[model samples]
Target: MGRMMLKNWLALLTAVFIGLSLAVISIVPPSPQGLDTPDDQFSSARAMVDVRMIAAAPHPTGSEENAKVRTYLAGQLTALGMDVDISASTLPEKALARLNRWSGQSKTEQPIYNVIGVLPGADRTKPALLLMAHHDTVWASPGSADDTVGIASILEIVRAVNETGQPARDLIVLFTDGEEVGLSGARHFFSENPLRNKVGAVINFEARGGGGTANLFQTSEGNGDAARLFARAVRQPSGNSAATYIYRILPNDTDLTPALKGDYAAYNIANIGKAEYYHSPKIDADALSESTVQHMGSQGLDLTRALLSADGFPRKKPDATFFDLFGLWTVIYAPVWGWAFLGVTLLCYILPLRRDMLRKDTLVGAVKMVGFMVIGGVVLFGLNALSGGGSGADYYDRLAAIPRLEAVAGLTIFAVFFGTFGRSQLSENGVLGATLPLFILAVAGQSIAPTATYFISLTVLLCAIATFIRRSKQTETYGQWISAAVAAILIGYMVSFGHLLMLGVGPDLPSVAILPAALAVLAILPLWRGLPKRVVTVASIASLGLAIAIALWIRLDPIASTVPLY
Candidate 1:
């Protein structure tokens, strides 16, 4: 018995290590490159980038704050003494008429404008490589991030070329309006575009939710002809972040999308239906990729994709979020998921579900161990929360505030035991045995100091383990499974909402697995306990089939994923 206890304890240790390991990996901020610092290391490229920043200052067209951005772009273009053409191409008639037809509604949408500056080439009729940026933003807060930066970038590049008094393929810098409002500016521009035939290529810049996690992945479809040229010419060693770099091609949504065409259908198409979007990392993690589109479209270009992102994951630091987990935020759902996992093991003991090597009594003890483990965690959490000058935020926030995943690892340990404890049946001894492992996971994440959400989840899962240990049979009834099912549905239904709420898997995979399994278990319980075997079995199977079929449909058949920008 002592040896068996030791083995389970070891397994618990393994799980804690795995969970905390990932947590640590996430908080690892990469070493900042001494790239182009103004003091001494500033390279010519750095100088160019900095100068560009000053020239493009604030061209946001969405709100009053961003209005300054637009004024700045105009001012910069005027200062350069170039032939500037401000094309009111965004809110043109035909596009709005079509938008009204598509959204199944209509209103006098804003007139989209494009600030077009043409610098004629030597033998000028060749389509020029136009530079583009949307003069708009996500919120009324400030367009400084999403596009003020992009607009400013265009101004610097265009102005620099103008200063040389030599045009590179007839530079046409278009500071587009209504880019947020459904590529109205772009769609309007293309409606009768000479630039389409003449423009050889384009360089479009985009700002995410934040500033400066510098990266530039190719966002165009034309292989990489001009893109490689720019990258090679603009070559400077990229910034390094110590953690995972989530640099996959985001399907069209950012301001760059309008320009890219498939990406803006504007930016993409303007670059002749194929172009690249210069991007940064900050926006991807928390906010504003879609806000730019949604905010614009809501004024009624009917922005959808950029209004709402594709993966719907918690991205750029959004304006506000509902991922508010009060007390049991962190650990609450982990167990909800963990219970499914725990049930798999416990089936060996109760359902005679599967043949496994782990002893039945040990499994039962593990399920029952939540109480002892959580009690220990409560004390630890209280002390740590107290000791750390705990903010009015979750563990993830505090951890992130402190900025290290390892700092919050201890809390994660607490949640991990919540998992093992959920699997084991309640027993006084079992609770005692589970305490140490739970403490370990919590301690690990706590050590890393995760983001507010991460730590909160960690804490909730820890408490859940404790609750399980104390309750002994939380899942003993059909009502419990029904409750679990409801929770799963709500959480799963909102996966696309992302950080707007804390329920991620609550909306996707867990709900997929849980909703049906929960319903089936609830429906079949009466039969398994003594109802007519045939009647119960048939009803259970039908219910399972229906539930799963619905889940499959939701997963497979996407309703409004690809929205038409035109």
Candidate 2:
């Protein structure tokens, strides 16, 4: 019994280490490139020069500092051989009122200047490709990561493009003003600027935090052609259809929001790590992550070059389901493929079931899994509330608490998993039964929201395959290893996806993590050997205690020092 327990512990540790390593690798941004990088390459060192200047201080729209940023950007564009103009326009009445309210001023007139630069191509008749970033900052924030990084990336991209010679079509650089206030500058340009007619494609850079991998989070509707183009062009891409689908339903908006009104293929890219730094006054050029800038610029440069060299822009087609596999490469397919995956999953699960496997154990397992999700979700919600979630919570303060909140969620999840399932050695029937709920969910998701349901279907499919492999080779050592390998892949993806979800909405809805945690648990259920009751109880208690402690710390802690005074 002692030897058996030791082997079980070793196997569990090995699987965990492999999964964690993969998760870290998948989420970590690339190393920053130095100024010594080739002129034709996108270097964060080169881009940081622009970031230092643009984000030296807050430059909200209508501020004097904004004028300085606009002028400096126009000059940079001109030096890169582009024709530059400052398109000045009055802020809309509603926008001006909001600004006044925030500033405690009653000014009736405020002007926003959009810096427009045109780099003519060999054939001017071709539709132009626009690279966009805002030049404005929120109040009290130096805004290095928010907009400066984006602006700097575009400058670096243009310099790199110039080094490679003229593009096939015109390249338009748009540094919009008033993005933080209400996207006033973008609204003006997309609505009234005649150049809008010339734009066939747009790549807008944005940031929500100081660091992390930049993901192509949003694309125009009917993004099949556009997504494929991105997959083909980007060497190190980070994105998925799930993100686009979720963002489409969310109430959030970027400058891309207005541009979507135009008939153009659009991509909205942003990094969302170090989420606490978002809109924080402490965020400055020095606080920003150079690797994040490099990641953004490198991906942007690759996609821009591809678009510039293409014969025509991507046309409207049904959106495709896609995701990057550990940031190595993208896997794209039609939404209909989800149904096929489900069909295969059903086959894998059904093929191995015996008459005895269809008994009460299976029902118990299904009930256990359902209970895991419900109890875990409720615990997460309760913990988030303890950490000052819900109404009247300070938005920026919650953003700042993300790292700690992630820890609390993670610890609580471990506690829930152990408390619920760690004490039992599930039967084959029980393991298969556990997957039924998620499988049903995948089917419903496929029927209603196919694009976002790939992860669900893929998770269930992988779990089913692992179950079949384990049952077929019940006594084989290699079978355990194969199942472990499959578990590692699923767990790694769930970890990374959970991190992203936490960054995106954990501040208010950390309970959402229960879905990924449950999925990951399903993958590991087959390998689980019942732990001693005392051990399981101790682990669950310790983890839950730590999570509760963290929640209390977050609740009692003062608002972040970096938070804007307003």
Global Cα RMSD, each model: 19.0, 1.4
CA displacement after TM-score superposition, residue 138 of candidate 1 (Å): 3.4
Q: Which has the greatest TM-score?
A: 2
Model 1 per-residue lDDT tens digits across residues 1-566: 46644544444344334433432322221232233323222122322343344323322233343455455556667776657766654355664565456445574764455777776666565445566667654322233444554554444344434444464346567777766556666665655566655654455555433322223333344222322222223222111110001122224454444344532212221110000111221222122232222111111111111111112211222111112121011111221333343333233223322233244553454333443334433433433343342444232222222211112222332232333332323332332233224334444433342212232223224333433433345544433333233233223322212211111111211212222222212211111112244554555445434433433333243322111122
Worst 10 residues of 2 by lDDT: 473-482
Ten contiguous residues with the weakest lDDT in model 1: 269-278
Instruction: Give the residue spans of candidate 1 off by over 4 A.
Output: 1-72, 89-109, 162-165, 222-227, 237-251, 258-566
The number of the candidate with the highest lDDT is 2
Clashing pairs in 2: none
Residue 16 error, candidate 2, Å: 1.2
Give the Cα error of residue 179 in candidate 1, in Å: 1.9
TM-score of 2: 0.98
TM-score, per-candidate, Cα-based: 0.38, 0.98
Cα distance off (Å), candidate 2, residue 235: 1.5
